[model samples]
Structure formats: structure tokens, C-alpha cells
Target: MASPRELTTPATLTEESVRRYREDGFVHVPRLLSPEEVSVYRAAAESILERDMEVWAGGDDGAAVEVNYTTQVWRKDETLRRLALHPALTGIAGRLAGVPLRLYSSEVLVKEPEGAPPTLLHDDEAGLPMDGLEQTLTAWIALVDVPVERGCLSYIPGSHLRADSERLRHMTSFEQFREPDEVWPDFPWRPRVTVPLRAGDVAFHHCRTLHWAGGNETDARRVGHGVIYMDAGTTYLPGVMDEYLAHMEPGQPLDDAELFPIVTS
Candidate 1:
């Protein structure tokens, strides 16, 4: 196992990967975590999920097959918090963002055996209550082998590069209200790419990238840890998420030492 300092000192990323992330709006890093580390996270995530947590199933009709998830596990578990601020992870995010980054939030998402439904296509920025939406992205670490049969993630390539337009705006709004099982054949978003990851692999996607995951068709469980990172200067948008971020005023930086630790400086 590599020491934390070693992991932080030299990030495991290539210039080509960075360029590909910029062009495609996402990048995959194989074996970002060691087998032992994968075991640790799997245990931690499972323990956290075992406790009472929120369950979100897409639209109104999807509640029957809700996906179980818990956010900000870093607040409760030291190991997860360390993973959230891991140097290698932060280094990848900072290099991709071209700026220093800070922790926005961390979540563990799970799909039960034959119980989870397909996730709707949506951009993270539409749901996040932050001003610097463009500067945000998520590092999704697979704790278990996520094959297509197990509902791996899929994304619209280069979707992040599209300028804000009426069509994009409408599509974002429509997605928010669409049912979990609904699929628009002529929805216009195209050239989608599905990514299957083995345990210990990580996928990084821009917040604006349109992405979704399939249903858990296999009998095994599918679990993923997603750590959202954003520019250090990103500010809170008061009305959107007043309950969770009321401590900070509108336009104020999300720099709480304990809540939003600076990952890259």
C-alpha cells in the first residue's frame, strides 16, 4: 500500500488523460485504489448505508425501487473523510479544473439486487445549489466491479461543451420532472458512451455532463462512492439550498474548515 504522502505528492494522471477529460467531459482512471483500499471503502460505505439514511428513487413513480444513498459520510467516518481529501484524488480534480479545489460533498450510492431502477439523464449542475457550477465535478469510485449488467454509468460525450441555449435549458428542466423509467427517443442528446469499471477504478465527470446509469439487473449489489469537488472560490446560492448551507451567506465562499475542507492548495 502506498503512503498518504506518496499518493498526494505525485498524482496518477497523464497529460493525455487531462486533455481527454477536457474534450470529452469525463475520464476514467483504472485501478485508482488498491484491492485492500477497496475493501476498506466497501466496508465503510456498507456500514454507513446500513444505518438509517435517505432513499431517493427518481421521479414520483420510482419510489418503489428507490436507490439507497447517504451523503457526507466524511462527517461521520474518518476513513471516508480521508478518502474525500486524498491527495491523488484532489490532484486529479485540480489539474482538470485548472484551479485549486475544495470538497463540495461526498456520497455513497447503492443499487440493490434487481431493485434499483435506471437513473434519468441529468446534469449535476442543475441539481447543485452553487454559483460556480461549471467548476464542479465528481470522482465516482467503484467499490465493486460495475459491469453493464450491473448498471454502469453512461454519459453524453462532449455534452459539457454545449453553450447554454433554449434546448439545453428545456432539456434540463424536463429531466428534473421526467420519470425514472422514461426515455426520450428524439431527445437530441446523442453520442452517449457507457463506462464499466472494475473495483478500485474511478471515473471523473464534469458537473455539466449529462449522465445516467442502468438498472441493477444482476443479483449482486452495485455500490459507488462519489466525491464532488469544486473550485475553492465557489460560492453558495442562498435560496436553493438554504437548509444545508445556511451558515454561509449568499455569494460567500464555501470554505468551512470542517465542512468543506480544501483538498488542493
Candidate 2:
């Protein structure tokens, strides 16, 4: 590997890119990150994943289901936090969402080599367990080369328009969420490109965009770092909320500087 390059803030989001994201509910930003930077953070992500595995293994009755996971890891890893707060990506997220932003969560997804389970097609807002929400977005950064066969993300075009697909919102449980084809029978499948990523590319999608990943059959693992951002000034609605944020009390404002600090360039 070559020496790491000087890490700086990300470039401004282009008008066409923003337009594409608004129209499609998802946009692929090519090479938003440098290979050197991805390499550095890839190791960081893997370390946190391996560390979690060890913890699970060390516990009593350590044997768990054979599955794919590595969620909410940034809480413990500094390197992950760095990537989550990187200005380049956050700048685009803020612009796309048309609001200041704060991190909702940072998760690491690992699709292990050979027959790794595919991610369920679902919307991020559905599982929030809250009602009346701000426009949130997710930045999915590819840490390694991810082809379609390796479980790259597939999204439904224009799925963000509430008027276009509102009835499907009630199906929020990711466990019960099915592939996009069955969601809205009236809209029909639109002929469009799927969102895949290179090692350093970042794909930003609206929180409610219909998306899914296929099973990974490759020998190489496909791993990605994902950051979800909520519109600034958004609050937690414990009344309709669920277990995801059980730690925090109900009705707490989400723009907590110490916890979900704003990511500004």
C-alpha cells in the first residue's frame, strides 16, 4: 500500500448530482473517498467486526446463529467515528437533505464470503418506530470492490416521492420487508440503473428509498461503512418509538452536540 494521502473535506455536491438524488431517491457519487483512505478505514471496520466476534464468542453459550452482521460499531471505534464525521460526505448529505445534519447512527455491514445472507429490501424510515419525521439520508461507503454478485445495493427509481409510493410505508419491519418488486403494484418497475460501488465510492440514498442487496457468493467479503443522518432539529418521538434508541429517554431532542453532533464543512 502506498502512504496515506492528506485527508481533507469533501467536494461540494453538484447540482446534477443533487437533482439525480432528488429524482431517484438515491445517487452514486464515484470515488468520493480516496483508495488510501478507504484502505485505512477498511482495516478499522474489520478490526471492530473481529473484536465484536470475539466478544460474542467469549460469552456464555457463545454459539449464535451463523449470519451476517457488524452493526453500530462506531460507538467504540475512533477510526469509524472519523469516517462518520468526514466533511466530504456530510456536506453532500446536508445539501441533499436540505438541512443541517446530525448523525443518527453509524453501522458496518459485512457480507462474508460465500453464501452470505442478502439484506432485506426495506426503508430506513419505516423501522424508526416514530411518526412525522424529517428527511433523513444514508451514506453508504464501499470499503472494498463490490460488484453486483457481491451483494451491491439495488434501488427502485423515484421511490422517494411520497405521492408516488405512500401505501408501502406501513411495511416498516425489516424482518418482514420483502423485495421491491412486490411493494407498489401500481407504480410498476421502472427501467433504471442499480446503485453499485467501487472501493472508494459513496452512495447516498434517501431514508425511505426502496433498497435491497443480493446474496454474496464470491470468495471475497463485501464490507461497507454506513452513516445515517437526520435532519437537524429533529427530535425523538418516544410515543411511537421502539427499541433502537432505548438508551435515551423519550422526547429528547436529537441535536445533542455531545452525542449526535452536527457534521459541518
Off by over 4 Å in 2: 1-12, 53-67, 130-132, 168-183, 238-244, 247-250
lDDT of 1 by residue, 22-43 (tens): 9999988777777888899899
- Residue-level lDDT of model 2, residues 1-265, one tens digit each, is 2234433234444688888888889988877788888999999988888877422121226332223446666677888888998878888787788777778788887777887656666677766644445578899999998898887888877777756355354433435544555656644645545667889888888887877777788899888988888876666665322566677765667766867788752
Q: What lDDT does each candidate get?
A: 0.77, 0.72
Question: Candidate 1, TM-score vs. the true structure?
Answer: 0.86
Candidate 2 C-alpha error for residue 165, in Å: 7.2
Candidate number achieving the greatest TM-score relative to the actual structure: 1
| Best-matching candidate per lDDT | 1
Backbone-clash count (model 1): 0
